[model samples]
Target: MGGESRIHNFGAGPAVLPLEVVTEVAESLPNMNDSGFGLMEVSHRSPAFQEVIDSAMGRMRRLLSVPDDYEVLFLQGGASTQFYMTALNLLSNGGAADFLVTGIWAKKALAEANRIGDGAAAWDDSSNGFKSVPGDGDYSVRDDAEYLHYTSNNTLFGTQFNHLPDSNGKPRVVDASSDICGAHLDVSKHDLIYAGAQKNLGPSGVTVVILSPWAASRGKEGLPTMLDYQTHISKGSMFNTPNTYGIFVLDKVLSWVERNGGLDGAIRRNQKKSGLIYDMLDGSDFWRPHAEVGSRSMMNVTWRLADEGLEDVFLSEAMDSGMGGLKGHRSVGGIRASLYNGCPVESVEALASFMAEFESRHG
Candidate 1:
């Protein structure tokens, strides 16, 4: 799949990775660091593997500018598991957490919290089909709430929070699974942030969690040894054998990000790539985007053609043109072009050219 014929991948998660990173991983697979053992075959506790995990976490801190008070954890179970873990750890004794339901993942996070204990939507936009973010007066925060939970980007709905919402001095927790390292964020403003590695980081088996010192202290006592964030933190994210190869790839990807000018460079490139598709959608009557103009996602550009039939034709033709993963999420049926940190300008331009030609032929 890393060969010259690789297609442009726009899948929402397990999305495209930097070609250079892929090549590096490919070369290391047969004999990593001249150890004569494939990365997958090595023991997680081995010194060589320990170096991989350590370098990965260190690079993550420097790239994201994580503070001294924060702890970075590499865990399994993806972002879904963190939904429950966040509530179990952060929601105070008999207190509720406020969730801002802007999209599918936020709703799922709220549901998971309710299943475990007390939680409520500070504001829910489900009634509006998640087409926009909340206006100034639309949502209110409770002073007594334990924390405010929100998803920074909605992969399915193709919407994103242009600005973090006000938590009214409460701890702000975010699920940034789809857009964590795609751009620079004010890490200090958030008490806890979690993201699955499949989208922008590395692969499916690893999840990255960044927790503030105060938040780490708030985890519920007597929890399972594995589910507890403190356990992983105290053990340096090796409480149990982690996804060694995934972390290895992640380290390489982070190194690529740093060498390519870090998060600032990623943001500029992402803006340019997504701009091509959004501009085409804006100028063409045949293609319509599902998201509101201001709330549109730079990571996943969701849009539709004139009708479902036309969308089918577009996807079929796009596949023939070497563009894959253009289908939309089931909940919101349309096209979603996920432009992650690794999606190159050339791929975006090719996709734009294809879109233009498709419109001219079928519009």
Candidate 2:
């Protein structure tokens, strides 16, 4: 999966990782850091394993410019789990939480909030088919709400919040699962941020939670040990056997990101990658982007062919040309090229070239 035969991966989650990280993981699988045991066999309590987790956390803090007051936890259960965790921990006693329903994930989060306690959709774009973010006047913050929850990027709809919604002096909880680390984000702006490792950080089985001091202080005491953020925070994300190998790979990936100039570097590369396909789409009458111009995502760029009949042909030909995972989500029947941080510029170029040739053949 590391050479020419490797199709340019554009899958949404559990997506591409830097080849260097993959190689390093492969090399270390048999014996990590000169230890006799494989990485998977190493005890999480051992010093060797501790070093891996520490380095991963340290690199993440540096890369995101996370403040000293923030607690970074490498918890299990992806962002989906976070939907309930956030509500359980933060939603005030009998107080409703406010949610901006921009896409499917946000809707799920809102539903979880309703089940956990009281919740309401402060703003929703479902009527518009989730094609765009709510305009400035379309939404308002609830002063009495416990916290505001929003999905920073809509992977399914291919829409992103270029500018975060105004939380209006309230604590903002962001589910940045897909677009985390893809740009220089002001981590201090939000009270809490959660992302699944499979998208841009590393592999599945781990979730990264960045909690500001304020957010950490609000956790409910009676919650189960595993569900409590404070539990992970106190133990330094070592409450149980952690995702040892996933953290190892994540450390390697973060090192790669740091070597490449951290978040700023990622922003430049992603912009270029997404821009290539977008420019092609904008210029061509054959391909049509689903997201609105101002709301398009830099990570997952989705589009469709003019003739639905040719969709199968395009996917088949793209696969023959060493391209993979261009099919969109089932909810949206078209194409989605997820250009996560690990995807190289070369792969985007190859994809762009393929799109051109495809359009030429089908036009």
Candidate 3:
């Protein structure tokens, strides 16, 4: 897809990607690393695929400044898996874990933790419609809590934590599915970090799991083989036939990030892209932006048309204008522009222009 064929996409997951990376992926589909096996058809145990996974892990370490003692594994399942796996592996026997319930995903994580042992909400913004994350003093961890879990960015509500939440010195577990490489994160501070690759990293099916030294060895025995983090860690994230094609695309995406100034660069661009939309939303009462000022996400900017019934019209016209994926999640029925690392500045400028024209005609 190119020029008129391509579009300014704002989908949440499996979002837009850099044209360069997409092109490279298409090129590699036929032959990858000069090997006889293609990217999708390559055996997980083959040498060519080994290089792909290795490069992905190494890039993740370098991009995030992950501590040397930490173990990085590209595992199956999505952030949903980490919700249960983290508690099963790290939560002490008969112990509880605390959660900051900022959105639907965090609430799901807490629910998953409860299935294993006890998961309590240290702080929750559900009462306020998931508009903001909590400050350190707003919540207290349980005395018996083994770890504190939080989602770095909430895609559905367009909220994000500007600073790391206070965990009361407990190990930090995060579901960073939406804003992993595009946002600021201190890998050394978190005991466990997991992200679904579909958003900022790559296509779906590949989930990056980073565990600290303690986390790697903290699991209780007798866990299922595939669900066990150590099982994958011991085999270098290849405990079974992994997501071969997904990992290869991930490596290519990371390579694109590396050449384009790494995580810092991605952050800068994400900020710029979201800022373009936020500025428009703030400048006019014609639009109602979600996620209070300081808690707004740099990845997803969501808002509603003040004029009733203009959302459908706006989406319809935006599609006609070559802009796609502006529809918000069902829970928040409005417009949502997900400006992930892959979304370029030009698309945002186009969206901003569209918003201006829509307001002029309808306001």
List per-prediction Cα lDDT, in the order shown.
Answer: 0.89, 0.89, 0.91
Q: What is the TM-score of each predicted model, taking all chains together?
A: 0.98, 0.98, 0.98
TM-score of 1: 0.98
Tell me the tens digit of each residue's lDDT in model 2 across 150-178: 98889998999998688767889999999
Per lDDT, the best of the predicted structures is: 3
Model 1 lDDT-worst window of ten: 132-141
Candidate 3 weakest ten by summed lDDT: 1-10
Model 3 residue 31 lDDT score: 89
Identify the runs in model 1 with alpha carbons over 4 angstroms from their true place. none
| Candidate 1, 1-363: lDDT as tens digits | 537989998888798898999998998988887888897898888888988888999999999999988999999999999998998888765688899999989999998898666789988889889988775567888878888998888899888888878888899999999999995578999999999999999978999999998889987779888888889999999988899999999999999999998999999998999899999999967888899998888999998787668888889899999999999998899799999998888999999999999888887
